[model samples]
Target: MQGSFCDNIVRSSTKDAMPDSLGNYLIPTSYSRIVARELGLQERELPRLLEGTGLPPHVLLAGDESRISGQQQLQVMTNARRISNDPAFGLRLGSQLTPRSHGPIGYLALSSPDLLTALKSLRDFLPIRIPFAQVDLHEQGQSMACDLTILLPAPTTQLRMLVECFALVIQSLVESFLGRELREASIHFEYDRPAYGDRYEKYIHSELHFAQPASRVVLPAHLLTEANPEGDANSYAAARDMCAALLEQVPVTALSMTDRVKRFLLAQPAGSVNEENVARSLYISRRTLARRLQAEGSSYRRIREDMMAEMAAVQLRQGQLSVESIAVLLGYHDSANFRRAFRRWYGCSPQSFRDGVKPE
Candidate 1:
């Protein structure tokens, strides 16, 4: 039997190149911090969990407008699974996630007049929450299905984590609006059953299916018209307006020089993305590259520094490598200098940061 209408969302590639002047494909850091918190990770433990993800610890700590790429976000999820030793971590994570956990998007959905309006708002503003995925809502006979398509390449674990978390979140949102769980709703996953698959029943009360063609959630069509008891048209309009304004800020551009540089850095091993080498790869003078990046609100030195700090924190958290080794890995010649820089980035010494001990 088919799972819920929103089941089996497929992943697809987009022909459009990376947008211009956009620092990178990013998702809100709030979501990452939420996942980390729910997984019981402490502030100091983040570096290890975020290792190799190219995400700066400060971004998550500051909880500002900063963003991390879809790839890095996936790395955090993968790390959480390993650290927590829970194969059904995603299911648990989703069950605890409230609409407000999504920030403005959550507010917008909560204020929507009905399920259909809420889903449409979610579809349109999804980019503001997770910029790397696309949502498609389809109408089937007596049912409505919402399919999720990820634009980035993801491993099996990352994909499974994302699909499962999203499915549960959607289910929770619908239940909140209906003031009860939709007994007729269901969930579907494209992957094979995991060893801990039985735990899914704990969170997903509806019918569940695996080894399907796509990942999606399905709901009965009649539920679409169910009025949200808390919905206020004025609140929804205000939230929607704010969401639209934010989406407009997302950069869109054909491949440009800035895009090329980011792509180059992502492909290279950590600490190897010096300006001279990057310039050589692009067949341009170092000065020319600097000028272009400056015009784009970025610089090679800034990018390299951010990348180095992110990788350094990750390595330190892993506990497998020494402080000296991590410094050299990031192209530093002296451990003393690395420690000083680490202090500036995270406001603490590397040792203190990695010990899962925070400075008072």
Candidate 2:
């Protein structure tokens, strides 16, 4: 009843770069399932894949969806990387992902008339498959560069695997589209060459470059115009529409630290939300909470101040609560201090701001 605006913000953006523990599963279970199969986990051994994520075994086994959290999927990948003997686990995982495994996005790509159209679908809807991953297509002389970036935070090992897996997945799709291996394409990785660098040369037919500013692939510009022999106009239209709908549906699994903090804070009961409370709720130390927020150009105090101001405005605008009551709701211990803060924020008294009366 106190946080009307906060309630609406939480409800509307539950899936937007925020934690979704109580909402419908936003992350597709495909990646987790793949890790299970890759590990050759027997029915009883499946728990190894789900170690710290608090997800049940059936969730991964139960078809493609029945969704899981991003943390759950990341946990499984972490387990797989630790368990697998192969140092190139990410590349190996990428090679194993079939087009069918990509779901509607794969269907859209396979059905696209030309490579450019297919790549465009990736650029526009990669988030549908991997919420934190984004692809930007650009022209670099005779080559088209598809720059890939992962925006969300995760464990260093898990993050590295996700990047390698996604880069290879995209490369595999490009090869699938051409119906041939790419001898001239070059892949630029954001990270330095790994200990098992030879595995990349062995698996990736493309010319490989590492230690670059970002992860990207450079290919002959003419390849984008080449027709897909398996292209189907009707299927492409249907799958493209489906990708659009799916992307619209979940709002993407946002692993952004700031967004997660904001959503969690807004959803908590008014007086119970604060820096200590947030750090505990988010499973991070106070120092970590402060550091992550600072990286995003925000601090816990800054976020709380902004939210309090907005809450004050909303309550005042509704005229449902007196200025004193609104101040209490926004965590102010005294109305006089609240009035001073409000005046500083709006350059006028709260009531006048609420009444839309400007300072003369």
Q: For residues 1-360, could you state the per-residue lDDT of candidate 1 as single tens digits? A: 122111211111121123224434567666776676676664566787788887756454421345666667788888888888888888877886667666556766777788898888778766666667677898989998888777767888877877887887788888888887757886878899889898988889899989988888988999999898863464344323323332233333344566566545543434545788677555457898899789989898787676667667756755666787667656677889999989988888999999877753
Q: After aligning candidate 1 to the native by TM-score, how far in Å is the CA of 292 from where it should be?
A: 40
Q: Which 10 residues in a row give candidate 1 its minimum summed lDDT? A: 4-13
lDDT, candidates in the order shown: 0.69, 0.68
> Candidate 2 on 1-360: residue-level lDDT in tens?
323322332343345434465532256676676776667665667777788988876555422234566666777787788788667888888877756566556766667788898888767655555666778998999999988877667766677787788778777778887788878798888888888898888778888888898888888998888788863464334323323332233222434666556555543334455787566544446898899889998998887776667667756776756787667666678999999988877789998998899963
Name model 1 segments beyond 4 Å from true.
Answer: 1-24, 235-360
For model 2, name the residue pairs that clash.
17-254
Give the Cα-based TM-score of candidate 1 against the true structure.
0.59
Could you tell me the lDDT of residue 220 within candidate 1? Answer: 93
**TM-score, per-candidate, Cα-based:** 0.59, 0.60
Candidate 2, overall lDDT? 0.68
Question: How many clashing pairs does model 1 include?
Answer: 13
RMSD after Cα superposition, model 2 = 19.1
